[model samples]
Target: MVLTLVRYIREKGMKPGDKLPSIRTFATELGVSQSQVRSGCLRAAAMGVLKIVPRSGCYLADVTLSGIIGPFTLLFEAMYMNVQPPLIDLYELKTTLERGIAKRVAVIRTIEDLAELKRLLDAMETATEHAEMVRLDELFHEKLASSTRNPLFFSLMQVIHSMLRQSRLSYKDFVSEFPQSRKDHRALYEALRDQDALKAGDIAEQHSNRRKLLLVKNY
Candidate 1:
């Protein structure tokens, strides 16, 4: 049941804020009980895919960049493909989430959280290879999401980040050859350490958008 709507959304490339069919309508279309469709809708809403407005019909929620990753990943895997469009879409989503998270982190990060971020950077430095770098990178974002003290934030981030990681091979070569990105990461860490929210957010968004542009240009 949950899988059905998820697959439908992925197939349709349904953007955030699109309206979904009503429970009765969808169930009739699927030849299932309305209760089943309603239950599925509830689950999808919980997963941040759909929103049920009290006075209005159900509509797609403004899902975070991280939230759409899982479906993108599934789309990639199922089709045995990674394409430019999904990559660009995912990057845009990450840009949105990172900026928002940066604002919160600027205000909310604790000393311990900053220390942990440094520790993640240290692990990233020691990773010493692409596979290890990817692993450490995931940990870094996951840890950042935790520092925000918002579970929903982390949940969306994990999905979005995971999507990017899974499709990274599509653009890894272009990104890997850039010497400046390594330096940028360090600079980003320093900004976070200082709790410089605006700087950090700007840097994060720029970093994501740059990659998206590069990927589009080269791949």
Candidate 2:
């Protein structure tokens, strides 16, 4: 049912935040019971694909197809077009890449890289919204990747972030840990500033572990 609704949405070219059709109308058109349509909408909302308001009905989430699917949306044409890689699988890849990339970046990062990261840290401190917080967090990691001077790792980081975005936002732990998260980021920055590769990698691993634990529990 979620796929059916998504198909209907894509066909109509609905924009983010656009109101979804009424459950009765959807049931009539999609040839499903209203209860079934409601159940599907609820599941989609849980998956972060739609927003359900008590008084306002359902609406499309602010997620794009490319963002919801993966960053490699335009990168290739694969046979499993309808399949999205498992969220845990993507998170595992991200965790692995970040650990190694953090070490390399610490050893090779330049003053310019530090400056950009510092700026992002400052912005993150002032960000109050969950969406903005997530955006800044992703940017902070992206900078770390770019600082490594390795285009492959940098591109992979982008893909990982894009694909895992919804997963990141689904958990309240992502926003609730803001203060501690800042300290984590600062620790990594300090490690980079001191060119301590081991320390940077350790911090990255610890950070990923915390998120991984929370992700598994929540998911």
- TM-scores, one per candidate: 0.62, 0.63
Quick one: how many clashes does candidate 1 have?
A: 1
Task: State the lDDT of candidate 2 residue by residue for 34-142, as single tens digits.
Answer: 9999998997787678899998899999985445544233232232246764666666877888899999998888899999999999998899999999899889998
Candidate number achieving the greatest lDDT relative to the actual structure = 2
Model 1 alpha-carbon drift over 4 Å, by segment: 1-85, 170-175
> What local lDDT score does residue 99 receive in model 2, on the 0 to 100 scale?
92
- Candidate 2 residues lying further than 4 Å off, grouped into runs, are 1-81
| Each model's lDDT | 0.73, 0.82
Clashing residue pairs in candidate 2 (N, C-alpha, C atoms within 3 angstroms): none
lDDT, candidate 1, 1-219, per-residue tens: 777887777787888788887788888878889998888888777767888988687887888766766654554444535443377777788778877887688778888988888887776655656666667767777787788887766776776666667556556574464445556667777788787888989887887687778766766
lDDT, model 2: 0.82
